[model samples]
Every structure is written in structure tokens, then in C-alpha cells.
Target: MSIKSTAARAFAAYVDRQTKRWSRRPIKSQHKVFQNLLKVAGNTAFAKAHSFNTIKTHKDFVNQVPVRDYEDLKPYIDRVVAGESDILWPGKPLYFAKTSGTTSGAKYIPLTKDSMPEHIKAARNAILSYIYETGNSNFVDGKMIFLQGSPVLEEQNGIQLGRLSGIVAHYVPDYLQRNRMPSWETNCIEDWETKVEAVIDETLPENMSVISGIPSWLQMYFERIVARTGKKVGEVFPDLSLLIYGGVNFEPYKAKFDALIGRKIDSIELFPASEGFFAYQDKQSEKGMLLLLDAGIFYEFIPADQFHEENPPRLTIGDVEIGVNYVMIISTTAGLWAYNIGDTIAFTSTKPYRVVVTGRIKHYISASGEHVIGKEVEEAMRVTVEKHGFIINEFTVAPQLETPAGELPYHEWFIEMDQRPDEQKIKEFTAALDQEMRQQNSYYDDLIKGKVLQPLKLRVLETGAFQQYMKSIGKLGGQNKLPRLSNDRKIAGFFENI
Candidate 1:
């Protein structure tokens, strides 16, 4: 009966209607999106170089443009940075989302005026879809705290540069800005410890209804708040109804978060990246997010197992099969043609296509030929948590390539513990985890049976080791996460001295 509630209901309904319409015929919608993207950027240098003008259909476009990663497209990006027009998109990008690169220093992904709206739309619709599905619009009357990166942006070649969350922060709609916290000044504090302290000061007493951020950082906030108030998160903010999270899997963090909160709150997962907003949890009953077919991006999927092939088969919405892991490829309004974002996902439903992110292409461990991915590692951790009755605050695994004197090479796990178990318990935990991983990955099982790899080594990290490492790298929060598994010990080495 309240005006605000009525307005929210209307908005949610409209978003639901639009989402249903777009998802009703996913294949056709994707085809139209692809054709439109090509038409919009047909005059750009990238399009011309890739023979976009001659492309009339999705198949034609795929055949013409070869898939490229960030490294392969660096030259064109440099040209764009040097103030070139129509180099990638129609004009220059509004900003660049600066993220860490797998093999090197940094990656600057373009965020164009044409494509930025898609990100905004997807973020808005995520909440609206939740509202529509749950009929819980009462939260609209309360505050929503979004734990994001610093709002302060740096200019590069006349375009802004910052983390994707920071760049997106600049575009927060005026209406929502009233209920969003902390203040812009507090958000600019780069140090995670200092920023979190400032956020607690600003928001501890507010009428908070929703909290949105990467789960790890959000967990940090919850821990800080609980420590200060000597109360559970639910006790501190009883009105809190929803937790929106992305950037990492929530399974490993679920139990820990629930224990901290003292009660269960509804949660929604999102699939967003610097490249584009791809999917959102549209229905409460559905485990996977509904892919945004009508977003200003065209999608292709290459089977993950074959992604390394020179000409691996690329399938579109029409041909992709459910349950098959595929590396996502995109040609977007930002003018990235057949760009591989390095994320691997599998479709859970094909009728109105939905997907769950499987893992990252580069974030895997294959030491001793036992290829272990993020999903497998997270599952192992989940089982370890359940069996040991312990909680892990953060963790990463890397290969110990050099054996100690006369031992076999094995995986080393550096874990930050929420509740440290005794030595015997830790040993039992590692054994259970190793067994679970071997059960999940046949290659790993084979390696263990053949005596080629030793049992996993566990290293307990200091309370804030992961935070300190992230802070040292200037990636303390907002979409940045420690790689779960790495082929090298670069990350493990950082924590060794700490």
C-alpha cells in the first residue's frame, strides 16, 4: 500500500516480463544479438580486420573471426589507449577495467559507452528479478550496502581506469545512491583493513536490508562487525534479507558465513566480469543463473577439453549441450570479436539456457599430470570442512615441484583457518581431502596409485595472511580473489615468509 512498495513491485514485474520475453527463445535471441553486434561495430578496425562486413550469420562470423585472449588483443587495446577512434568499438572506451593477468602484470579491459549500460542493466535486473521471484520488495524501503572498490578513478589516455567494481560504482543510479553506503570518501580508502574499519563506522547502525560483495570481503566485514558488537550478523542487522555475491564459488564459504550470520539469508549468484554482465539467478528454484541472451554481447562456447586446440570447435546457443564444460567466447558491443574470457562454464538447462561457472582455464593445477580445477578443489574443501568440523577462512593450492631430498612431488595447500584444529585433526583433514580429490579426478587418483605424487602437504597460515598478500598486491577487495590452484608457486611463495 506504500507508494515505494508499489513502485518497486511495478519495476520488478516489468523486469520479469522483459527477462521472460528474452529467454523464451534463447537461440533466436542470441542470433539477433550477434547480428546486431556485428552491425554496430562493422565499421570498427577490429571488425574490418576480421572481415565483419561480409559476415551475414553467426556461422559466418565464427568462421571469419579467430578467438583471441587478452594477450592476443593487446595491440588493438594499445591503439585504443593511444586515442584511436574505431580501433575496437565505435569510439573510445569510457573506462578500462584493470584486472590481474594470469601470466603477466595487468589486463585492461575496455568498458564502452555502448556496453556499460549492459552491466548496469544486469546489476539492476539481478535485484529486480530477485524481488519478482521472491515477492520481497519490503527491502526496497531499507538500505543496501554494496562492498565495492574505491570510487576514485585514475585517468589514462583520456579514459578512466580502475577495478571493474570501482568503474561500476561511478555509474550507480541516482535513486539507489540515497540508500547505498559507505560514503564515497570511505570507499576511496585503498587499504582493506582501514576501508573495512571505516565501513563499519559508517554502516553499523544503519537499517540494512541487503549486503552485496565478493563473499570473502563480506565475511571480513561480518567478522569485524560481530567482534565489535559481540553479536551475530543477524542480531546486528535483523532486517538483512538478501546477500548478493559473485566473483567466486560460495559453497566453500557457505558454512562459515552461516555460522557468522547466526541465521540463513536468501542469496543470489551472479556471473559478471569486466567484459560484460552475462547471467543472473532469475528464479529461486533454479540452481544455475539464466544467461542474458539479449544483453549486448554475442556468445560462443568451446569445449574446455579442446580449448587448447588450434581450431577447437565453437558452438553457439543453438548447438551447445547441457552438462558439457565450455570456455565462453564473446563478441560484444565493446568490439571484442571472438574474445575468450578464459572462464569455463557448463549449461544446467538448455530450453531456456542456464549456466554454472565451472572454473577458470588458467587457474588449475596439473602437477604430476593430475589436472585439478577450481570446482574439484572447492568440492574437496567442502568435504574437508564437513568431515573435520573446521572452517577455512581462505585457501590456495600449488604444486611443490621440488621434492624434499627423497620424496615424490605433491600438492601443497596453504590455508587460512577460521578455527584451527589440532595437529592430528589437521592430518586427518588433509587425508580426507586428498581422498576426496582423488575420487573426483581420475588422473589424480592414477597418479596417487602409481606413486608418482605424494600426499598433499598442509601449511596453516597466520590469521590474515591472505588479506596481507592481497593488500600487498593492491587487490584487497572487490572481485579479486586468490587463485584456488596454480601451476606455479608464485602465490605459495608469497605466504611462505609470512
Candidate 2:
């Protein structure tokens, strides 16, 4: 390793040690530490600049502060945008991580100098854990690739200085800087359309080993890599040991990825948003686990059953139970207190706190008076595909309420298959999907008996097609993801050309 890498690795080692030490604490003690961190960082009037020394206990913080969301904090963010230094976290607030949600409207989330370390630390832990699980740490000896957003910070005038991906690119270790593109830094080359093309050309180099990005974007890149290099992913990047991905679910995209690589590539999932690096997959087979970073945030959960309950209990990490679905609420060093991130999760177990992302609390379809969740749809789709002996490359389901001529309410599946199957096969597949839905949800069964629910409508796409559409639209990147369901009548219009 070069001198800078040596120094960086040393810092990494120290952080890893600290994290392992923290991870060893008894469950309650770890939760206490998490709570204390929040109390120190969450003072309402004084939270703009936190003093870590003042916070002592969870009780002190919980009682003093009420749960808050971005709507509640908008005024503070506005003041910061107006160049008020003290409204947000103290020190120079460099820029906000842009995010949008139902309640937040549009958020320009504040990021401090301190944000990168937490982000990097959680990432490193994820890497180390994957390495340990797969026994492939040595595969990282070659050029490390990151497919991220350009680091260009946005200005008020609608001109962007640099892409966020570029910002992350510039901060790469000095040793790796020589191995990367200097052209990646110049903001003058603001043409992202051309930059992406050039990056695709450069990525065809022989030495790159680890590749990371959102699944959709990475799939596009993999297509480019194969086309340019005339080699499969495994042949071109023989040293590739890990495929790190985040920002969306990987289940539907798994078959497409395996086909590109010509085999299974070890993969890890990152559950990060602009707010902070929330969690990362710690093991290969474990989808998305909560690798809790106590140093950064305090976590709370509201039971799914009690989500609409008045005065519902907001249970801390200490109070979490296995197999329960809960809405994740966070208190972060970045000054979000008991903020509902609007994501729901089901804990597989609590001994080590494994969570499967259930769905967006706000993003669901209720049709014919029965609510359908994202996870339920995903599971039903999984069953459908398995029964058909085929795999779903990508899919979205929209609920169309039909007063079935003489039957019950049903669903319409807008499926993007990796390859086409026969009409008979499609019928069998939809029947299996309906069976899975009936088994999982009693409401669907009741609706079917009442002839209020209709049978599922299957709309299949041509192979390798939707991807090309997304590419043509210039949305093949880290933050952009395929919409899972298009409920509007425009869905037909959108797919009519396909």
C-alpha cells in the first residue's frame, strides 16, 4: 500500500476496532449508547451546534424532545438556505443532500463536514463484513470502482457546480487518484450526457475489480462493458469479488445481474439515503441487515399494528422485537430527531437485529378496499416467477378495480420479464400469483368470493426492453429507480409504444 493508503487503512482499522467494541455491548447497553448519542445531538434550540458532553441518558433526551419530521424542520432549512449559519447544525453547512418525500415536500438536507466519516465508516464495515463472509478481501487489491452520483453541488440559480458523484470521486484517496480520471474533477466539463459516455469508455479498462452502483444503472453499465470489451463480466473483470449496491431492491434484478456476470457475483446491499447511511447488508445471503451505527443515530420503531393508533408507542432499539413490522424513526447527528424516514421494515430476528425492508409507508396501493403492500407484491411475484420456471427481470403491479362481471376484485401485473414465455405459461403463472395472494391476504380471498375482485391481468414486456427505455430517458444512474407500480391510466399510454 502507498503511504496515504497506509494512513487511511490505519484510520479504518481504528474505526473498525471502535465499532467492534461498541457492537460487543449487551443489547440494552448498546441501545442506551444510541439514545445518549441522540440526546446530545438533538437539542431543539441548541441543536444547531451540539456539545456531546452534555447528554447523559435516554430518558433525558426522550422527554425533552418530541418526534419531528422534515415538515417540522423546514423553517430551519429555509433559514440555512438563506445563508443563516446558525439555523442548522453549527459550522459551515456545505450543502444539503437532496431528497424528496410525501411529507418533506422537497428536502435540501444539510450535510456537514462530519457526514463523510459516518458514511465512510458504515461503508467500510459493510465491506469488511462481506469480505469476512465471502473470504474475498484479497479481490480488492485491484482498482476499486464506485458508480456514484457526480459530486456537483447544486446552486440556487438552477446551475449545478458539480454532480454529487463527482464530489465523491474527488475525495478518493490520493493513491487511487492517480489511478482515476483527473477529467472527473473539472466542473467545466459539465456535460453529463457526454461524461457518462466517456466514463463508459474509460470503464472498459482491464484493471477494474470492484464495481458499485444502483442496480438499474449498474445493469446499464454492465451492458456497455460487455459490448465494448466483447467479454462477459467474469471474463473482463476476473478479479471482481464484490458487487456493492444500494438505493433499491436487488431481488427483481438478480437474474439480470447473474446473466451479465455469467455466474453469481458476491453482492452487498446498502440502505443509505441523503439523510445518512442507515444500514448495510452484513452477510452475503442476508438481504439487508441493520448494521446499526450507534455513533451516528438513535433508532425507534412504531409497531405496524399501532401505526394509526393515537399515542402509539415509539419503542427504542431496546424495545424492538423479532418478526414485528415497524416504521423506522431516526434521531441522527445531522439533527433529525425522531424523524419518520417513511420506510417500514420487518425484523427477521432481533438477536442481531436483521431487518427486511418491507415497503414505503406511503407507497402502497389500496384497491377495491383492500390494501396491497410492496413486500406482499414482491413475494407474490416471486412465487409467480418460480412457478413459471422463469425469473422476473423487473416488474410493477398496479391495482385496477373492476366490478368483475360476475367475480371478485383482482390485480393487473405489469411485468418486465427477462425473456418471454408462452401464453399458456403466462396463464399458469398468473394463477399461481393469485393463489399466493389469496394465501397471504385474507381480504383478497373475501373479495374474490364476493366477485368484487377481478383476475390478475398480465402485461409482459419484450426482453432487455424497459432498460433501453430508461437509458434513452437518461435516467440510468444511481438515484433513479424503476417505478414498481404505475397506477395511472397513463400506464397504458407509457407502455403502448413498448
Candidate 3:
């Protein structure tokens, strides 16, 4: 083994030892985090408005601070953006992680000096966990690439503002700086297509081992690489061993990734957002991630079923149950208290507090009484594809409330594939998918049986249809995720003309 690999393994051992302390005693760690956040939060303007001085316990916090989304917290965040100190956090945020929003136009999430390291440390340890578990660390010496947004950022009132990935670009550790790709000039390209091309050119001859990005964008990059080199990624970079992905469920895309890579390699899933770093998959053999309880963020849970009610029962890690959907609430050192980041997750292990991100709170189809979520659709597609041998590039579902005269309403799925299914095969594929959906969500099954809804219809999209749609919206790159399913016709309507 190389000297660097030996050193990495040693460090991984040390990290695993330290991580055990908090992971083993998650409830205690969370209580300590809650206390620390409460103590420091008393100085902020949000705290003053919410009666933070009088709060002493979790029950007091629940009464004092109601759950608030970005819109509810915007007033305080607005002041922070205007160079006001002690508005949200104790001082102006070190950086504003600007992200695209569905209802809110643009959201600027704060990252304080205290909270920034949480993001970096979780990401670092995720890789170290892999090294320690598998006893393989030689990939550290090879080239690593993270497909992301431009590193260039804008300034607002002396505070740097950019995509969270771009802000993180500035903080790439010195040890890995020499091994990271593509060149800075290539990464700064404004157009995503051009950037992907440039990135391919820069790394075509290098030893790329670790690749990370949102799965969809990474798919586009991998396709481009194949088009250039006329070889699978595994053949192009024999050393490539690990993939790190987040922002969406990777299930539906796993088949395509496996085909492109031409072999199996390990991958790590991360639950991260502009608001906070939540979890990372610590074991290659496991599905869920280890939730970070002591990472400068205190967490709460609201059962997803009761989330719409006026006073949903709030839960701590101690009260959360396995397989029960819950809306994740966070109080972070970045000064977001009782903040609803909008993602829903379920605990897979309560002992160490491991969770799987299920879906977004707002991004669902409940147009009819049958609520369908991202996780269900993703799993259904995965199962259908595996059983029927039909590979898909990308897909999304939207309700088709308007149908032909006298025809029942049904769900419409826009599917993109490199290889077209024959007419009869298409029929079989759709039927298989419909059956899977019916099995996954009982409400959907009842609707089909009751004749309230028709079986879902499918539309085959041309190659690159989803990518083209993303580009049309000026969100072609950098931390952007295409919605898997929407209640409205926004994405569905766009697919209609195509």
C-alpha cells in the first residue's frame, strides 16, 4: 500500500472510534445539541421574538417555536441578507446558500462559521467510513471529480452568495486539491452542456476513482463520456470504485448506472441540503444513513400523516418509529429554529438513529384523495424495470385530470429511454408499472378498483427530453433536481408539447 493509503486508513480508524461515542448514545447527544442551540439562540432576533429566554426544555421549545417553512422564516432571513448581525444568527452568515424554490422564488439559506464545518465533516467521514469498513483507501491517490455548479459566486451586502455546492467548492481540503478535477476554468463554465464537454476533455486521460453528484446530472456526464471514449466508464478508468450521490432517490437510475459503469462498485447516499447536513450511508451493505445528532443541529419529527393538522404531535429521535414517515424538523446553529426543510424521512434504525429520506413534503400527487409520493413511484419503476427488462433513462409522473370525453382520469407518466419498447412491450411495461403502483400504495389500488381512476398512461420521451426540459427552465446545472412527481401540470404540461 502507498503511504497516503496507509495514512488514510489510520485516520479512518480514528474517526470511526470518535463517531462511535455519539452514534452509540444518540439520545444523549441530541439533548446536548438541543441545550447548546437553545443557549446560543437566545442572542438572535428570531429568538427574542419567539420568547427564547423563557424556554427551558423541549416541551417549552415546542410551545414557543412553531414549525416554519422558508416563507415563514423569510422576514428574519431578509434582515440577515441585508448585512444585519444578530438577526438570524449572532452575526451575518459567512455565506448564503442560494437555492431554487417551488413556491418561494429564490431561497437564501444561512451557513454560519459554526455550522459550515458540519457540512464538510459529514462528507469527509462518509468516505472514511467506506475506507474503514472495506479496508480499501488507495482510491484517495487517484483523481476525484464532483460534478457540480460553478464555483464563481455573487456578493450581497459583503456576504458571498451562491449554490451550496459552489460555496463548498471554495473549501476543498488541501490534501485532495491536487487530485480533484476538472480544471477550475472548466468548472466555471456558465453553460452546463459546455461544462460537461470540457470536463470530459480534462479527465479523459486521468485516473478517476471517486465521482460524486446529483444522480441525474451524473447520468448526463457519464453518457457524454461514453459518447466520447466509446467505452464503459469502468474500462475508461479502471481505478474508479466509488460513487457519491444525493438530492434524489437513486433506485430508478441504478440500472442505468450499472449498465454504464459495466460493473458493480460501491456508492454512498447523503442527506444534505442548504439548511443542514443530516445523514450519510455508513455501511455499503445497508440502505439507510447514520443520522447526525451531534453535528451542531438538533432534530425533531412530525408524523407525515398528521403534518397538515394544526398541532401535529412532535417527536424526538427517541420517539420516532421504524417505517413511519415523518417530516424532518431542524434547529441548526445557522439560526434556523423549528425550521421545516420540507424533506420527509423514516428511521430504519433507532439505536444509532439511521434514516432514509422518503420524499419532499410539497412534491407529491394528491390531486385526488390518493396521495402518491416520490419513494413509491421510484420503487415501482425499479421493480417494473427489473422484472420486464426495460431500461429507463429518466421519468416523472403527473395527474391527468383532463382526459378524453367519457374517459376516467388517470396518471400520466413521461418516460425517457435510449431503446424504445415495441408497441406490445409498451403495453406490458405500463401494465407491470400500474400493478407495482397498486401494490405499493393501497389508496391507488382502491381508486383503480373503484373505477374512480383509470390505469396510468405512458408517453415515451425522446432521448435527452428531461435534460432539454431542465435547460429550458434555465436550471440546467448546479444542485438542481427535476421533480419526480408534481400535483399540478407544470412538468406534465411541458412534456405534452414535446
Best by lDDT: 3
lDDT for model 2 comes to 0.66
- What's the TM-score of each model vs. the native? 0.96, 0.84, 0.99
**Model 1: lDDT of residue 214:** 92
RMSD of each: 1.7, 4.2, 0.9
Write candidate 3's Cα lDDT for 1-498 as tens digits.
888899999999999999998989988999999998888877888888888889888999999899999999998898898899998778789999999977789999999999999999999999999999999898999999998888899999989999898888899999999999988888889898999999999998999999999998899999988988899999998999999999889988998999999999999999889999999999888869999989999999999989999899999888989999899999999999899999999888877778998898898988778889888898899999999988799999999988889999999999999999799999999999999999999999999999999999999999999988998998987788888899999998887888
In candidate 2, which residue ranges exceed 4 Å CA deviation?
A: 1-17, 26-64, 100-106, 155-166, 178-196, 227-230, 285-287, 402-408, 463-478, 486-493, 496-498
Lowest summed lDDT across 10 adjacent residues in model 2 is found at 157-166
lDDT of 2 by residue, 75-157 (tens): 76677666665444544355566653445455766666666567766777787666555545555456666766666566753
Q: Is candidate 2 or candidate 3 better by lDDT?
A: 3
Candidate 1 TM-score versus the reference: 0.96
User: Per-residue lDDT for 42 in model 1?
Assistant: 79
Give the lDDT of residue 264 in candidate 1: 95
Per-residue lDDT over 313-428 for candidate 1, one digit per residue giving the tens place of the 0 to 100 score: 98888889988889999988887878989889989998689998889998899867787888888888998788777878889999997877888999999998866778999888
Off by over 4 Å in 3: none
